[model samples]
Structures are given as structure tokens and as C-alpha cells.
Target chain A: MSVVPDSSTDASGVGADPRTGPAPGPSRAARLATRGIPLLVLLVLLASAPLFAAPFTANTLSRILIFALFAVSLDLLVGITGLPSLGHAAYFGVGAYTAGLVSIHWTSAAPVPVLLAAAVGALAAVATGWLAVRSGGVYFLMLTLAIGELVHQLAQSLSSVTGGSNGLFGIPSVRIGGEPLTLAGYVYWYVLAVAVLGFLGLWLVARSPFGATLRGIRDNEPRMRSLGYSPFRYKYLAFVVAGGFAGLAGGLFAALVRIVNPSDAGFTTSALILLAVVLGGAGTLWGPVLGAAVVVLVRDTFGPQLDGHGPLLLGVVFVVAVYVLPRGFAGLAGLVPGRRRSTGGTA
Target chain B: MAGWFDANLVSILNGFAIGSLLFILAVGLSIVFGMMDVLNLAHGAFFLVGSYLAVSFVAGVSWGGFLAALAVAALFGLLAGGVLSGMTEPLARRPILDQALLTLGISLIVAEVLSIIYGNNVRSVPGPPGLDGSVQVAGSTYPTYRLMLIAVGLLLALVVWLVVERTSIGALVRASVADREMVSAMGIDNRKVKFAVLGIGSMLAAVAGVLGAPVYGARPGLDKTILILALVVVVIGGLGSVRGALIGALVIGQVESLGRALLPELASFILFGTLALVLIIRPRGLFAGKVAHS
Candidate 1:
């Protein structure tokens, strides 16, 4: 019944597989031109976006950045750690709710709510991750899904706290040093700053030694175990960190949208983020971010114009992407000029 | 004790009624996963299709009309299942998640198409004229349709059990579940078996949808709700086991009804709490079949 080949073989071949392996050495100038220059250019464009773009366009871009962070956080578990979670929005929703409640009842101070959201998100992950990490593969997916649904139910039933299906509304705009960031451009800048930090944190974790250990576990748990690494501990930590980042994204989301609803933490949100991760390429950090942008554009921007048939288009994308873009947009990196084609096909 | 029984008797019966409906829906999911290694996420969409068909063809109609609706829904489900099976066949060599996502996509499209046709309003199907009225049961008034539902569910369960446990074709299905390679080695076309299982499983889901229409009503999100419930039933009962599906569905049914009656505040969490508890104790479920090789 098992379709997966032996883990040993998979681990041995990982280095040769272009999708999972590090690129062969390139000169510093070439690397600078290929990676650094494009990243810098993109950052500059994003920084200047609100200056030139319309208010509506700026607002939509903020949403994309928030979800891009959310998707990248998911990539930590799914792409790097080899754990495909379907309920990640649980933490994201928890973070959003925390931010909303804090902003409403305590302080609208921007950093305070966002920080608390991240902390609470980590706590929620620790609470659920212990049980979820016990199982692997599809079972893990199902367990996380159940956990997500439970959170959604809690959000719905705990009306006094979460405001129930009506959602928690009337949240004040986030304040910076006692002044509210009311304008769309100001809010966009705030969101972009936080999102970039969250992305960098996740990117660092993915490149760190700990991240490599996670990749080891994903490729072959038994080998890692024999090498004296506790797979569970590493996996649990990754899940917590990812949850924290997801929460950070959620906090950003609440600040931008000023409303937190049950659907924010529901299965649909979780599934959409998962689809983004897959569509962008699971393990590629930047790929999922791109996927998130596409997904957000399709559902939020183009959806209204399509007579609310955005989901139909999304569904078609899910099917078509799985079949045609198995490696996602990240897999097309080799097609660029002056880039060497990666050895081997799909992993 | 008698007073309490009188007060909660309706809830208990409601449990059975819902349990029977769940069994019909989940058995197909359980067995298909076991035999074909495919998790048909579109199972709920199939159920939704049936409920809508019930709304269109069975509501306010005669008994013959309701029966004809069931036949039509079943046939439609079979065809849908066949197409799904074919779509998923090529992805067999890939990860199971691919198949899951594909089915999810199909379900999304189906749901979108359905909502477009039926609108977002909640549409309830009424029982046939003869079965629509209330009848006395143990000194309490109850809907006659529910009692009939219980009887029908029990009869269907028996038929399924007998077919799976006592018949030759059932043996083939069991064998296929245990070891597809060995069954294929014996010259059986595993693909045909898979196709049949998918078709039959889908048919069962649609039939349950029609049966559950009066109780659940046809709505936009009903498909997702039913799908989640069926998934829970399958998980608790042990995937791919008909007997497991029966026990799991009944257990969840009672939990759902009794929880709502007893602790309305925690009603939603009760079912998932049970699932978590089960996972902690026996992650493979209560009646897990032989552990398939990973």
C-alpha cells in the first residue's frame, strides 16, 4: 500500500536532486547578479509601491504580503520538515484573535499586540503539536485538520470571547508611539516592515543548521535517529516556530483588516495556504510567497469581478497545478539565462 | 430513571437515526480507502448532490417519486465516481496527497456548481405523505419518518454486512484490501475492483444524502459538514472496515445527539474531544485492520 520508496535511497539521492540540493558553486559576482540584485530591486519596488499605487491597490498588496508570510511559515513544516499540515491556520487565527483582543481591551500599541500574538500562537502550537507530531504522513494531516476544526468551533461557540460567527469587530487601528497609523499607505508600510521581518526569520531558520537537521529528519528519520538526533524534539520545535510566525502573520492580518472572524482560522483558510505552498513549490521559501500572491490575487482581487466564481477558478488551479507544475514556479528557476539546469527531474 | 428516559428518549432515537445515516455515508469511504488507498474527499459533494436531488425530485412528492429520485441519484453518483476514479488513476504512482488534492478540487467545482443551481437558501425535503406524520412510540410522540429511517438503516447495514462477509464478491473486496498484489497475481483485475469500489462507495454516499435530506436539509455548506462527519466516523471506526464504520457512526451519532442534549455549550467540541481521546489511546482506531506496510 505504501507508494514511497525507501528512505535510505531517497536520502542518498537528495544531494543530486536539483529541487532539494544546493546549487553547485558559482562565482561571487554571478551569485550577486542572480540572487542579490533581483532581491534588492524587488524590495525597492515594494518600498515605493504605496507612493505610486492607488489606495485599493496598496491595500490589496498588504494582504498579499500578510498571506505570503503565512504561506512561508507553512513552508517550514511542509517543505523543510517534511510535515504536511492542513490545520496551520489554527495558529494564524489564534494570533489574529489575540491581536484583536489586545488591541481592543488593552493597548492598540502596534508591537505589543503583534508580540503577544506570536507568543500565544507558539503556545497554541505547543499545546497541539505534541499530539499531532506522534503521527506522520496522512495521519498527521488529518490530526491537524481535526485540531483546526476544533479551534474554528471554539471561535464560533465562544461568542463572549471571539464574538462568535459575527466575529470580533470595531478594533482600533494600530498605534505607533501614541499616534494611530490611519492612512492606507501608513498601514501598508507597517505591514510590510513586519512581514519582511517574519519572512527573514523563517528564511534564516530554513538555512540554519537546525533547518538542515529538519531536512535530515524529513528525508530519513531512522538514519537521523541512529545519528543520535531526536526527530520528535526537532519536529516539535519547528512546528512551534512555524506557528509563531504564522501568528505574526495573523497579527498583521488583524491590524490590516481590523476584523477577526471564525473563517480566518477555519479549514478553508488552512487549505488555501496549503495550496499556496504547493503552488509555489513546497520547499522553496520564495516560491510559496509567490504562490500566496497569486492565490490572493485570484480570490480577493479577481474574485469579485468573476461573479464570485473565484473558488471555481481556484479549484481548477489546484487540479492543474498538481498535474502541470509539480515542482511549482520555483522549479522554473533553471530556465533563467546564465543558470545551470538542475540535475535530475522531480523529487 | 423512567422520567429521565422519557425526557431523553427522543434524543436517543435521534442518535440512532443519525447514526444509521452516517453508517451509510461512511462505509463507502472506509472501504474505498482500505481497498483502493484513495481518500475520496469528494464523498460529501456526492452526498450534497443527493440532498439537492431530494429537494428537486422527492420533496412534496409521492413515494414512487422519492424512490425514483434515489435511483437517479445513485446512478448519477456511480457515473461521477467512475470519472473520479479515472482521473485519479494516473496519479496512483504519485503521492496519495495528490489524489486527495485532486478530489478536493473536484469537490470544490461540484460545490460551486451546486450552489449556483440551488441558490444559497436552506431547502428542506419533507417525508412522503404516509410517513410524514407523528406516531406514538413508547407513550411519546415521534416523527414516523425517523422510525422508518432507523428501520431502513438497520436493513441496509445488514445487507452490507452480509454482502461483505458472506458473499464471493465480498471476499474479492476483502482480499484486495489485504493484498492487492496477491489478488492481481491470482489474475484478478485490480483496476476493475478499484473502479467498482469507487462506484459503489459513491452510490452509498448519494443514497445516504437522499435519506438524510429531511434531517440535514440542503444548504451551501452542508457538503463540508457531512464530509467532516464522515471523515470522523471513518477515523474512529478504523478505515476500510465496514464493521468499523457501523460502530464508529453509531458512537458518533450518540455522542452528537447526547452531547447537544446534555451540554449544549460544548456540543461541537464533544465529537472532536472523543476523536482526540481515541487518537491518544489507539491512534489506529478502535477496530483497526492489519497494519499496511508503509
Candidate 2:
């Protein structure tokens, strides 16, 4: 909690001078003001989106919420923990499969499937992370990719359970108090409520001591180890937490689409989610949500017009973003308030 | 017993052919990452283009046009390498993730453009005319084209090994791989060596792509599949080791073929299983190479 403000100020590059304020307390309050105002306005806008948005736009926003939550979970590993997992969609897929299976076999009851999906996702993460976290850097990336591929293969081969290549369809609608969420507005509200809770939960974790320890691990694993902290343990716990949230997002996706396929677990999906996190300014939790919106909008707006060339537009967006907006939307936010002397510095 | 022997022999031959293709793909990736510290995910795009170009040449002209396709692909590789260098050198101080994302974007663009031009259907290319007939071996008839693949693989292995281990350029590359700053401090132009290696590596991938189209077909997303498989080969064989890639490719090729024969439903899992086991047993890979830890 204590480190969050300092890191934010460092990232912003505005509060570099120590003599900017009369006291430390005032500086902290100022930091919160600069960040919090934008967050509040964004929250209000997201919450009220269904009021004025069209049905298609509302549905797109709902899809964005699911992907945003997933991307944020990936950010926990990539940005905060310095573990860039390419197999993140494995857990997401597991959650989606669990939820889809539940709706098909056991019940259409919403909470039960979501909770079960979370549990399955966390367990899968632990199982995979145990071996994966043992290696660092490129090896870690490779291991995660292999594990993700294995899961994808499983999804395809387990035909009876997963419905094979065609995927599990006709998943019952998520019901709230015996009422199905049929309309786009209703689905949006439901997804928004879930997303809010999910975001707040993750925000609390990010602002906690655990989050600070993760940042420390990311910056210097050896130093953390020298200070008597087990880096492996922290990484494992973080992976589990990230996987849990990814699973929740997966459940939302399954409900949103009413189907789950092996493609959901594919490496391309994982890459896109990672791209979203990077585009959003990795460490900032909320930035990924905005990143997801940009990616989804890019895909949606040009996808039909370009047909098969949609990924080409996205590729252009990625390359341009890397060169032009290196710090992503969060960095852009810092520039808007003119806190930093120059926006050219590395984030 | 004779029947079993014939089947096993054929499987082994097929695996080597597949493995030979993988070696060409993986070596480029391994060398680029090992020497330059850049994981060029776009390496796959080079291969994708080669495959598509080969398909076009073979269909429009003749099988003899395969060589022309390879030449064009190599030229394209050089141009692409120059473009990549231009894009990446400006951001030389950026993190590996940023560089990787940039390369990935290039790859995605290539793949999409190819799909747009070729229209996403899987297209196969026939081998050159002379390599069409089947050869009888161990009581089984096998495509002579596959044997030619093995021969190509062996020749490439020998050529690469001789060049890397026996040539002046190879020594420079080795020295650069061991200590880049030290090599540069000695007044050696390491940047040129890096570019040369990148260009050569990309060319190798293109050649593999031309050869691979006959067996695997040219298709959208072929880049992603081949990229993952090649990465796995590099990891299992140990990064930057030419010999390791050869051995690793052979092993994966066998696993893929045998798994397809035995457990068709679990062919991909067999490869993943090997990867997991190898990583657990030797995190640096089965044959640790000159590449440094990240």
C-alpha cells in the first residue's frame, strides 16, 4: 500500500522533486487526486454505458469487460510479477470449459458454475505453475506455451465432454433469481456488476502488501531472495490469483457467447490478451481494460470491412503502438495532466 | 516380425524427413536468439512467405521453379531483415518484450497479407519431377521425395556445421555469442555479423518453407504452428546448438509420427509431453548450448 503511491509518482515522472509539497501527507493526497479523478469519471461512464448505447455497442462493451478482466489478470503476471506467460488462455479456457460443461450437464444456475470455474482455474494454474515457475525468462515462456498447447489438444480430443471441434453450444443463459439475462442491456448490467466486483477485488490486491512484494520480485528476484523472501512462493500465489480471475472472466465469456470451443484455449488468444496488457501500460490494473477496448474496437470496426485482413490492421496498430505509445493508455493518462516534464522517457 | 520391421523403418524415415524440415526452421530461430538476443517471432512469417511463394511458382510454372522460389525467398529474407533491423535498431534500448511484440506484429501482418492474397485455403505443392517415384525398402514402398528430404537435411546439417564450426565468420559469430561487448571492444564490427546472421537465418527459414509446402501445404496460420514446433525443437535441443536442433527435430518428428500412428487423438500431446519431461529434467535443454540465461 505504501509503495503504490511512490511507484505511481515515479512512473508519472512529475513528482520527481522532493520539495513539491509542504509535507508527505499532502503529496500523497495530491497523488490520489491526480489518479482518482480520472478513474471515477471512467467508472461512471462505464456504468452508464447501457443507458445511451445501442444494442451492438452494449454487447461489444460486455465483451470488452470480459477480456479486460482477463488482460488485467495477465498483467498481474507480466507487469507486476515479471512473468510473461504465453499460456494464460489455458486457464481462461479451463474456466470457460468448466462453466460451459456445468451449464450443459449440471445446472444453469449462475453462481455455482462461476465458482466452480474459479476453483478449476486456480487448480490448473497451480498444477502448471509448479513446474513453469521453476524456470525464468524464455524458458518460462516456452513451458507455458507447451502447457497451453497441451490443454488445447485436450480440449479437442476430449470430444464427448468438450463437444470436439464444434464446441459446446446451447449453453443456458445466466439466470438471476429465476430470470434469464436475455436482452443486451440485461447482459451488460450483469457483466458490469461482475466486472466491477472483479476489478475492485484486483485493485485491493494491487494496493496491498502482496502487490508490493510482487513488484519487488519483478524488479529484483535475487535481492528479494536475499531478504528471506521465497520468490517461487510469491510467483506461485500470484499465478493462482491471476488464474482465478481469468477463470471468472472465462465464465463471463462462455455466458456471453453461449458456447466454448478449443480455439478459446489456443495460443493466438493468449497472445492477444498479452498484447492487450502491454498496450494498456502493463503494471496499471485499469489500463488493460482500456487496452481491451482499443483492441476490440480495432477488430470490430475494421474486421468486417477488411475481412481476412483484420489482423493486418491489428498488426499495424501493435507496431505503431510499440513505437508511438510505448507506455500505453496509462502513460497517455499521465501526459494529459502534464505531470511529467517530457513524455519521451521510457515508462 | 518382418511386417513390424517394415513399418518401423518407414516411420523412422518419415520422422527424419519431418525432423529435417524442423532443423532448417529451428536453426534460424536459435541462431537469431542466441547471437542477437532477439526472439524474432517473425521468423515464422519468412517461412510462411516461402511456402506460399513455392506454391505459386510450382503451380504457375514447373517443379523446377522451386529453386527460383527459394532464391526469391532468400532475397525477400534479406529485404525483410533490413526492414526488421531498421525497425528494431531505433528501439535497441527497449526490453525484449517490446522487441518481441514488434516482431510479432510484423509476423501477423505478413500472415494476414498472405491470407488476403491467397484466400486462406490450404494449398499443396508437388515435389520436383524426378523425386516423384516410390522406392522399395524393407518390404515397403516409400516416396522418394521423402528420402530426398532426409538427404537435404543431412547436407544442410553438414554445411551449417562446417560453416559455423570451421569458417572465419563462424568464429566471429561464436565470439560474439560468447561476449558481444568484448568482441566489439576488440574492434570487430559485431553489428555487421549480427545482421549477416539474421539474414542467413531468415534465408534458411525460407528454404525450409519452400521444402515444407509439399508436405504440409501453404495455409494461413501455418506460421503459428511451425513457429511453436520450431521453438519446441530449439528448447529441447538446447538453444543455439546446430547439432542439438538436428537431434531434437528428429526426436519430435518421431514422436509426432508414431503418436499419429498409435494414438491419433493425442498426437500433439505426445510432443508436449516430451517438452515437459525435457524441461523438468534439463531446464537448459537436452544439449545446453552457448546461449546465456535471460
Candidate 3:
């Protein structure tokens, strides 16, 4: 609650200083900002997709980019906040359904539905977060899971609105500023911009004072309480914020696909996000983006071709990550001679 | 008035029948969770495995072979538990995130392997010959197999209660769960205890699956559904507590069965409603059981 940013309080012991803030000499924030330049450059490359990659490849890239936004939001909770939520798909579904419903009935500009989607996502988070923040440790994990499952069940059952087991189809393309954004190349550019902005925003949040407080709560809740900070408040804020981003991503997805299905809220979506976080290294800003790309690519390459072996391969990869690279893909930095040390195992 | 009482009693019995089976399955889940910290997301896989294996076992043999099938299912649980232990052992050192991910991966693998072996189709195991018939109960002709299922569920629940509450191995397991380091310090290798407990837990799940197949039916996605229900049971029953498991099972089972019978449309929603209400009141679980650590 204090406005003064306490630079010294790494007291919440979850991980090292992920927040690149007002430190001495050139400021770590500036350095991180500079480091982010390459990511932007990559984003630029992604945006000009049809020029470099094939249309199908470009569409794949767009899908990955959209998922990357979702994954990055997940990383806020899973990696940075040290709350490895297994059921974030609740928010994702909320956002998608919001947009889906909006698009189905009333013809509106894309931004309206997107905003509504984010709003629904935030609302869902607030509702669920109120209950979810009570329990810490494993119990917290289970509670979030239940909430996510509950939402999924609701969405599946409310067929009149959600279209039930059979999802809404033939949804018109997103009408943006009185123009239809139907081109895949245009969508890819939009997705890339959104993902880049999402990452940047989260990265900034991770460096902010609120981020430091979350770290404290994650590492040692009792100690945080001793320091006069309520862990529940901090957790609730972070949960809602994370949910908001998930909604943002979900809205973007609904617009692009023009449909929202039950899978949007299922365990598989949760698993996918979890895998991405674990792969990219949960707390790192760029980790989920990288992990999402890898997961999407692997599935795109192998899943359809492998016929019944896709899940087996993915499962094997997941097991290998758990045992071998607990820190995720970004965890490889630890193995390098002079690279940054990790906060914990990749998972 | 008599007819109304009879109708309500029938619904309640039907609910109890379902609840008892859930108790059987969830008891194993509760015990394993209580004794060992492993979530065993793959626990439901063992149940599915039990159902399929029972189908194979029944195809060749007579009623005497049911005992053999049950034993085989138990043995499978033991082997599966061993594999699960091996996979989750490293992450088991740390809490929470590791256990969750490792078990989740194991579950995925089990599901994939099952699909590879059995294909993505619903398959049924025929009830034992004599029990295949229906019996008149409370003016409703319930399947004889369902009645046997209730009997088997209760019988297994009793045996589990006896072994866990009264047996030496149960005591050792409980003690280890209380303090693993202390138990190990006392020269009672907690690993052995964990392995044994996991084995029994898995056996319980398998037996539940076998018995449940004729009553609840079998499908490709049964593992996933069973896993979610078992989790609900664990949360309701309290982590690692046998008594908690029984209550949780009965409550969830009744909700599921009655929901199916009465509210045909909202059957799935009913199970979740009970879970949500319980979770709101008691986040640690309605019954925390005897384990010191969550």
C-alpha cells in the first residue's frame, strides 16, 4: 500500500530481483528496456509475415502470436508472481465467450467486444480471486482449479448463449473501425503488435512496486504478514490483473477465429499454458513467448502427422522438462558459464 | 404418505449406491494423498485400467475368476504406483508446483498410452453372469449388478477401513505422513511405507474401477472424469484423511447419482455445486484428516 518503492525489500524470497527498477548506475530498467529491442525487432519480422513466410505459415505464426499473449499473461501469475495457476483457462474462456456472444448478437466495432471481453475476464477473476486468495500453497492450487472447472461447466451447459457442446460457428470476421480485418497477413501484424505490447506491459508490471510486493507474498506469506503486508490483497490484485490479460488474449483469439468453443475453457488449454510457462521459464518476460512458439511449432509439425502419437510425444517432452530443465527454456541460461542464475527449477 | 416415503427412500438408496462407490474410489485417493504427498493424477488411469483388464479377465473365466481379476487389478495398482513413485520422486522433494506438473505429465502419458492400446472408443465389461440380471428393490427393478456393485463398494470400504485403521502397515504409513524425516530417522524407511501405501491406494482405485464399470459404465474419457471427482473427494474429505474420504465420497456420489436421476439436464452441474459449496466453507477440506502437513 505504501507509495514509496522499497528497493531493499527482496524480503519475499520466491526469486531474485525480477523487477528492473530504480537501482543504481545506468538503472537496470534502462538495460532491460535496451535488451527488449531485439524482441521488438523479432516482432517486426513477424509482422511482415506474408513477405517472408508462406500464408499457411503466416497464419500459424499469427495463432502462435495470439497464444503467446495468453501465455505471457499466464507467466505473470505462474512465473513472476510465483503462483503457478493450473486453471487460468477460466479467464481465457470468459474473454472468448464475452467476445463470442457480443459478436453473435450485436454487430459492433472490434474494440467494443475486445473491451467487453477484458471486462468479463477481470470480473471473473475478481469473483474467483475472492475465494482463490484465501488458500496459499497446494490448497490455493486446488481452489483455482475448481473455479476454472466450474466456469468451464457453466459455459458448456449454457448452450443457448454459448452454443453448448457444439460451439458457435460461422462467426463474421472482426469489424475494426468500419473495415473488416479479414486478411491473415493483417491479423498476423495485429497479433504481433498485441503480443509485443502485452509482454512489454507485463514486463513493466513485473518491475513495478506492486511486482516487488507480489514477490514478497510468494516467497514467504508469514513473513510478508510480519512485514504488515496482507498477502491476500496482493494475491487478489495480481490474480485479477493476470485474468485481465488472459481475457485480452482470449478476445483477440475470438476475433481472429470468429468462434469460441468449450475447448477454450478446458483442461487442455490449462495444460498448454502450463507447458508454455514451464518451457519458457515462468517468471521471465520472454520465456512464455518462446515456449508458446515451440509448443505451437512442435504440435503443428508433429500432431497431425503423428496420428495418435502426438499426445505421447508432448507428454514425453513435458516429463523431460520436469526432470531435466525444471527452469524452462530460459533456464538454459543458467547452464552457461556467466549467464544469470535462476530463481528455482524451470517448472 | 407411504408412497412418498418409498419414493424418497428409493432416491436416497440410489444416491447411497452411487455415493458408496465414490467412497470406494475416493477412499484410495484420500489414503494415498494422506500417506504420500503425491497427487497421483494418474490414479484414475489405474481405475480405467482395472475396468479394461476386468473385461479381459471376465471373457475367459467363471465367477471364481472375479477374485483373480481383483487381485490382478491390485497388482496393477502396485506396479502403476511404483512407476508413479519413480516419476514423481525427484519433484516430491519439493512441494506444490513440481508434484502438480509431474503428475499431470504422467496422467497425459497414461491417457495417450491407453488410447494407443484401446483406441478412442467406449467399451463395456459385461457384469458377472448371475449378477447380470435385475432385482426388484423398493418398487423399482434395479439392475442386480448395481446391487452387487453397492455390496462390493461397502465390502471394499470396510476392508480399507480395517487395513488402514487397524493394521501395522497403516500405522507406519500414517506415522510417516505425519513426519517423513522423523519416521526415516526412526529407521522406518518412509520410502517403503510410501511405496506400499501408493500400491494399496492404486489397488483401491482399480477395484473401484472394476466394480464401477458395470454400474457407472466405462468410456475413453472415464479417467479424466474420475480424476476430477477424486480431486473433489480429496478436497472435501480432507487431505490424506480416510474418514474425510468416506464423507467426501458419499456426498459427491449422492450428488452425482441423484443429479443424474432427477435433474437429468443439470447432472454435471450438481456434482460441481456440491464441490463449490464445500470449498467455499472449508478450503482446507471439510475433513483435514490426520496429516500434519497439507
DockQ of 2: 0.49
Clashes of each: 1, 0, 12
Candidate 2 or 1, higher DockQ: 2
Fnat scores for every prediction: 0.39, 0.57, 0.39
Query: Between candidates 2 and 3, which one is better according to lDDT?
Result: 2
Docking class of 2: medium
> Which candidate has the highest DockQ of all?
2
Candidate order, lDDT descending: 1, 2, 3
| lDDT value for model 3 | 0.74
TM-score of chain A of 1: 0.90
What does chain B score (TM) in every candidate? 0.97, 0.95, 0.90
The local lDDT score (0 to 100) that residue B167 gets in candidate 2 is: 98
Candidate 3 structure quality by residue, lDDT tens digits, A48-129: 6678787788788878877888898888787666777878998998998888888778874757777788889999899778
* Candidate 1 lDDT by residue in tens digits, A1-347: 12223222122122122233344455546755777788889999999999999999999999999999999999889877878887999999999999999999999897999999999999999999987887565667667877888788889989999999999998899999999999999999999999999987887677666776777777667888999999989999999999999999999999999999998998779889988988887776888899999999999977898788777788899889878876678766633223122211112
Poorly placed runs, candidate 1 (over 4 Å): A1-23, A27-33, A335-347
Instruction: Report every candidate's CA lDDT.
Output: 0.84, 0.80, 0.74
Candidate 2 C-alpha lDDT tens digits along B5-32: 5668877788888899999988888877
Name model 3 segments beyond 4 Å from true: A1-15, A18-34, A335-347, B1-5, B8-11, B57-69
